[model samples]
Target: MPRPPYLGWLAATLVGLFAFVIRMLRLGEPGEIYFDETYYAKDAFGLRTYGVEHETVENADALLAQGNHDIWTGTGDFVVHPPMGKWMIALGDYLWGLLPFGAAMSPTGWRVAAAVVGALSVVLLVRLALRMTRSVLLAASAGLVLALDGLHFTMSRIAMVDIFLMFWVLAGFTCLVVDRDRMRERIADLTAAGQHAAGWLGFRGWRLAAGLCFGMACATKWSALFYLAAFGLLTVAWDYGARRSAGQRGVPGRWLLFDAIPAFFATVGVAFVVYLASWIGWFTSPIGWGRHWAAENVTGIWARLPEPVLAVVNPLRSLVHYHAEMMNFHTGLSSSHDYASRPWEWIIMRTPVAFFYNGDETTCGAANCSRAILAIGSPAVWWLSIAACLVMIGWWVTYRDWRAGAVLLGVAAGWLPWFTYPERTMFVFYALPMLPFLALAIVLALGLLMGRDADDPQYSPRRRIVGGVGYGVVMLLIVANFLFFYPVLSAQIIPYEQWADRMWFDTWIYGSSGSG
Candidate 1:
């Protein structure tokens, strides 16, 4: 009904900037490997040193802390996850290593990429929210809530690849949203101008971009496959609805012929290409695990192929076997972990993973001091989002609101798959990717509460006032909750009593509450 709120861009910029700075501030505190950092930081250094992750010297963590850069044992390590995320960590190493006193072993050097990507996710979410709501303030609120989220903040400051996975998944979803808007606009305009059947609406650039985003996401973590499938189906459903609304005949068949086929090429085929490209390091490296599997073990169907064809097919076959081994490892993993949580407990903030903990560091002005980095989310945000998601589900079922359906699908894709692997050991940070969509659910719920914009002919001031007040209160609670937990989230040195006081339940304490 009116010009789009372009001011939303400015708000997004400011929020993103704030998020980036805050994430980077004190990022190197404690200055040692914590939690999975023991694996990823060293693995990143190995990738940078050897092109593939290399086995490290015994007590490599201790050696790195002692400023030894020569920790390579000169053998490839059999890591579970893909190399793309390790490569992302290695980027920080490559850049920061150039500076004096900054090297791959430095916590800050390896962790920089996570903070940057995590903040960029906030920026992307703000813009996506703005596009969905057409409201400037609500968009910024989404960014702010995401920024203030304790889980997001903690994950951002770590060197783990989960933050990278979160960023790329959000990026892919954002690209799809943009494509939806552009395609729908084209169909509406063409139909209104008496062109009911506008075949092949040129190249959908945004959709292709989404493919690249998802490619990078899956490269970061195979779990991204869930989101890729969900979003692909979503965009296709949108295509069928758009064509049907435009009065085009045979909507289903038309969609299958034009939209579905092209979309498959754009997203699935392109994603496959990108996923292959991410393995260039491993493919080229002489020491990559299983790199020579095909050549070493040619049998059955492989033995039937001609030598010429076998040469060309060797690498692909090796990669397939590698993937199979990875799949087996993932499915069979049932290692007991203190902080392992069920998918249901993740939403309720039941058990938080303590990333770093130390009472020996003498900094606090108390005899008994505690310093820790805990990856727990703000309770206010998570609890309210559950209610917000409920409201969104109602809107989706009653009115078929595309935004609501999209948010719900995103949450389901990120979360539901874990239920199938109830035996798999999981952590709270694995739920990080779902946080952004919940933030959107909260914003979308607010929009439904407010009805129409103030300038609308029948806008309700009372509704706006009520919704605005409710949103403001929730924002306050989120900020306060985060601030209260900021000490533990950032590994700040606080009195032991304060740390114990912050723990409302025994499950929240990941380790012994040692006396300083």
Candidate 2:
């Protein structure tokens, strides 16, 4: 009933609205498919046309622009990732590209979905920050930081699936936090009711929702499996902690029976079901790549099943076989890329992926012109987050702060897994899914510096003023940094000198400046 919460939501919504409008601005620039859009945008169009993604013919971009929708090469493509994200992108094409509302090949039509998902991420960060920290300032700050990050901005405007992956991972993490709170509350209530153990909290809907979100995340990219696994274990830990706090006897056994078992069914089990369901388009299509693998190569268990059972099981078997092939591709994908970066370098954004660049252009009314879309985070937010992450680790170690551990785990789940594949061709922008956690760490660290509540007489006003001013200055810096790189981030046609000047490091300059 308090006015502050309402004001907080208003601020958050306004920030997200700003993100959406800015992302939508000049979204059709360069007016051609470039980078990974060549793969995803066309695949999205195919998904809209057929039940599955089909291979595209050459000059697909120009063909689509000429209103030629027959770009598919008559067979399904062997895309590694699942169909969930392409389906999301296809929605934008359906609304904007089909009805004379916009050109079929308009960049705006395909990119709108990414923009919307990116903006929604900002809103989710605000809600999450508010949940963790009651202060509206912290919540709004986290949203603003993400809104201004160049990596987020560029990813928001592209048709690539990483933005959807980021959105779903964040959603799942948020849902798990809610589930933690719900489970803890149930424990408190039951323990107060003269009971040593809190029995099963029927079904735990939030955990199930978390599973669905994580399933969508994994369905977007198999890399999301890292977060799904990490978060699944984290939720079980939360359950154990909640039971121990409630003074339950045989807490380990109680947690396993009442919480851990259901948590698994709600998360991992449901996630497997949803992940399998996401491939239905490919599974049903007769000509889909690898759809007949199991039927043709059934050798296990003597292949003794009846035709009906074989028919039913063959689909699932083929899906499993496809996944194995995809995993092989992922592991052996060490093919060199110009913008590839190591996991260590990604900590400081050493090598940002160039999403788009105008290689030979004279459109800026200058001797030389460049238009680019560079994927990099705002330096102020990202650099500050390094210290913030260290701070969170310390808090978790020293005080065993659950909030700090949650933030650290979120970042780790999104990150660390990449390091295991040191030879993998990875780009700095692959770190996108972890940005929300970094923002949370930054805001939380700043909040700690801001002393305790203003109402607490023991809190130092001087420290509060220092932290508040420091936070404001950081916000200003993030905005200024974003503006300075806006031309490169948004693929704006600018003088080559201006674009080069925006390039902070040699790695950035070496990356594509929309020159492709």
Worst 10 residues of 1 by lDDT: 507-516
State TM-scores per candidate: 0.96, 0.96
Residue clash pairs of candidate 1: none
- The residue-by-residue lDDT of candidate 1 on 217-305, one tens digit each, is 89989999999999999999999988987898767777898899999889988888999999888888888888899999999888999
lDDT tens readout by residue for model 2, 321-365: 888988898899998788888888777887888777775779889
- Candidate 1 matches the true fold with a TM-score of 0.96
- For model 2, the superposed segments whose C-alpha errors exceed 4 Å read 1-4, 98-100, 300-302, 512-516
Model 1 stretches with alpha carbons more than 4 Å out: 1-6, 99-104, 510-516
Q: Model 1 lDDT vs. the true structure? A: 0.88
